[model samples]
Target: MTNPVKGPTGRVPGWVKVVGSVVLLLAVLFAGLRLSVLPGLKDLFGTETRDRSGPALLESIQDISRYEAASGNFQVVVDLEKDAKFLPDAVRGSRTLYVGAGTVDAYVDLGALDGDDVRVDDDRTSATLRLPHARLGTPALDPERSYAVSKQRGLLDRLGDLFSDNPHSEQAVQKLAVRHIGDAAKESGLTGRAESNTTEMLENLLRSLGFKEVRVTYGD
Candidate 1:
């Protein structure tokens, strides 16, 4: 009988092993690049190195009502103009007209209240409460409605603006317009009106709570 022929054992070739190593190295490098660029990828893949939500988680459950009070909204329109001159009037640089529409808030804070500020008359028939005075908050300019009504820039003005740190001079003018709106709202008795409205509101609320008489006053 002829000797049985031996078949070659099945095994991966050396070239195949080298190719597999290169592919694995490339895959590891690509993964490292992605992880470096996208820090959130680690969290998405459940490989976050550390927890960073401690403070945010704690703040999420805290109450925010301890700092607020009654607020009233007032709409105001402010017209303002500013002129910057590099030379004589003949060489006027820029004259800008800004029209700003702002919403001003007037608030009455109750955070300063104490037990003595609220007094109940004998027999509990009436209650008198003294509250802090109403004050005006900053005016929030409406980006949609507030804009540069007109801007006239002379040759020098345009030339200087090209190199100035603040290229847009209208922005500063718009800020001034907003400030004027807040000032105008305050001067228009807006805060006093807010105080009156707040007092009336609180009086009605207290009356609804079975108080025969409710007197609400504001302190200086």
Candidate 2:
């Protein structure tokens, strides 16, 4: 009463059955292996994420689309991030703006935050700016005089960056450092806000010194 499904012989043919079972088992093992390994392939369908801190290749920048301007002031739109974009098809391509483009010696008077980041009345070429003031509080830095905020670390970072063939590597490092330390840092003595303003001032000063089409915002 051996099953006829076993093959032409009354008893299952050893070779045929073994071959059939082995094929079936191999198929199953392959399927199981594929199932076990499949989820990892899900991420592969997508490409790796990219960061464009500075200008991109193949693409060009023109007409830096005027992202933000403080209404009628000095027409200021500062992009704190390096990837600020522009019209892609212009004759002149994308150029990046960076820090160290100005003197870190920008002097903040211990006056008041008159909300005067920049002020322009009308038909005036030379505008006035009342940048944020600092008291340095009880351990006060003198109001009439100037004080250095001491971004010397930033300077050293830039120096290292200069020697490196790729400046973006430093920026990448900065981005990482910002991610790790940024939270506690904001609440710490040096608010990232202050650092940001400093950067903005540096850019604006350079803009006045004649860097065209500047912007200041968080990286979009």
Model 1 C-alpha lDDT per residue in residues 95-156, reported as the tens digit of each score: 66666776776778776788999999778779999888888777787778767767776677
Put down candidate 2 lDDT per residue, 41-129, tens digits, no spaces.
Answer: 64555468789698757766554211121111011111233222452323222223222111111133423334445554454444444
Q: Looking at model 2, how many pairs of residues clash? A: 10
Model 1's lDDT to the true fold? 0.71
Give one clash count per candidate, in the order shown. 0, 10
Candidate 2 regions with alpha-carbon error over 4 angstroms: 1-118, 122-125, 128-183, 192-220
Candidate 1 residue runs with Cα over 4 Å from true position: 1-92, 164-166
Q: Give the range where candidate 2 is weakest over 10 consecutive residues by summed lDDT.
A: 69-78
